[model samples]
Target: MTDGSIQQTRLPTRTVVLHIGRHKTGSSSIQATLRHNQAQLLQRGVLVPKNLPPNLSGFFSHVFSRAPEALKFNVERGHGRQQAQKHGNRLLERLAHELEAFTGNRIVLSGEEACALHPDEVAQVRDRLGPVLAPAGQQVDFRVLLYTRDPVAYASSAMQQNIKKNVKLLEDHKPVVLRKAPGWYQRTHAAWAGVFGADAVEFRSFETACAAPGGLIGDFLTAAGIPPEGIEPQRANDSIADEIAGFLSSSHVPKLPPDQRGLWSAGFDLSTADQEILFAIRGSKGGLLTASEQAGLWDAVAADMRFIEREFGITYGAAQTAGAVPFGPVFMDDLKAALPRLSPPVRRGLLAYLRDRSAPGDPGQLQPEGI
Candidate 1:
């Protein structure tokens, strides 16, 4: 689908819904739901692309066009700016073609990476599509949906994912995350609003949406103007269990050099019993936030949360301002009960780690804001 193949044909009037993500907000789940219900949605006059990248879970999957430079080069096959823009223009052409042929009243194009697009890139998107969707008697609306989460929770989840990707412990990489954490949720949404009219932007709290009647998927369908009846929600990208998360946070497995880490993980084995024990400890541990740390992070994002609530007319669990307190010292009784399942080395490591981390940290130590 090159730029040359697409003609500058005017598309029929329709509602364009763009889901720009603040990541770690269950965008994956939403995308999966959208894919699963593509047929039903089309039947209901909501057209969506049938061939989105399943692996990336993105509506459009050209790395050069969709990702930022640093991410594109480091994570994907590196391409120059000219190449990216060229490819992006091609994608817009395809999008225009799809819209031109679409008979539906609504068309949805969802991609989390779109949230990272520069203003100019966004302008390119609008300009490229604007001609294709010019007013045609029927109303033409361009709307963007953005889902936000609490800063601490989002960061904690992002940290978990980052560690999973690279061979790095939480401590080794957390400093960078805390220092450059994405606290600009408000700014990001504002950028989209500026480009696509304030009235055109739809802001929703991921937490609140997840807690809604049908959970995240249900709430997203409702937001997408899809009826939720008969839709079976499937959870995607499930997080590692809390105790295992804690172990991974402290362990050097992911922190090993790339080669060694791969080999270690490949050869490493865990018993069914140990796996069960670890799974049992799920929800026992959360983000490494002390009572004070949680409160501080919450306060830092208080303004952002307030802005979202005021602008979107929705509450994002205001009552739950603080994250759960960090786990207290390991209970010897519980530890003893679980010792039979763990390998000797793991058992010893857990004992030492727990013993050493029993005491509360120094209150004077610097902590990242809004993390």
Candidate 2:
């Protein structure tokens, strides 16, 4: 009986879903899913632009292209946002043309680094999209979606990631210096709300979203107004096991490229007992924060947790009350139990490491090179 039932209907409405990530919040999985399901999304009248980089996080650099002053000096030097904007603008213009031609109702773009931009820089993004989208006779709905994580957990994970990338946090004795203390979520949320209007900005807890029926991928699909019934939620850029991550993060270990490092993670065929050791190591919180720092971090983020609970209607379990030593008796027990199954050099290293720990005043003894 509807008009579309008798004849083909050109979708007139278009929605722009902007996903700004606070990093380490499963943004990769969501991006990978969107990239993988582009065809399906198109069929459903959703346009996930093919012109954008395969990893949508690359779009963050594009947003930053015109706002060089806003980029923090320490981290933004190499992102090449200025040069990238030229390429991105061309894509955006092309996307505008495509949006006019395509019979789709939705467009999705995502980037974690976009959340790093100041409010003024984010306004530039809105300015770019405005003229293009405004020309459409149909209504334009622009929305911003942000996934927020527990500050303590986010900081711990980010620290581990930095170390994995060979930042030498431990070696430099400045591991926690760069990490923002608490209130980051509030500040960032305010900025986004200010730019997009309060109603247009939606906040979703990363923990809750990831734990939803279809995990992060499904959660994001649902958020983008797409159905999640038949999609696979594959994790991308998965973190390595704690023991493996620990080994790579050790001060003396040489840094390897990400792909090569991933190979190391894949190559380890851990047994059940070995898994127990790895689990214990992981439980140690990536060995990144000292106990006092960990406790204080939770305390600092407590207010944000309350705000998240009240504002987002999501409540998480209380943060850990105390910090744990990076390695513990469980690690030692599992390591000892699994030693015979390990390779010769690894066995030698583990044995030597244990021996050195037991003897006092033996700081530099038998620290195996190829562990």
- What TM-score does each of the candidates earn? 0.72, 0.72
Backbone clashes counted, model 1:
1
Give lDDT tens digits, candidate 1, residues 66-96: 4533443323556655665556556556656
Give per-residue CA lDDT, model 2, range 158-178, as digits (tens).
755654444433334234533
lDDT to native, each model: 0.61, 0.63
lDDT of 2: 0.63
Return the clash pairs for model 1, or none: 167-254
Q: Which stretches of candidate 2 lie over 4 Å from their true place?
A: 1-11, 64-85, 97-100, 133-135, 167-179, 254-287, 316-318, 321-371
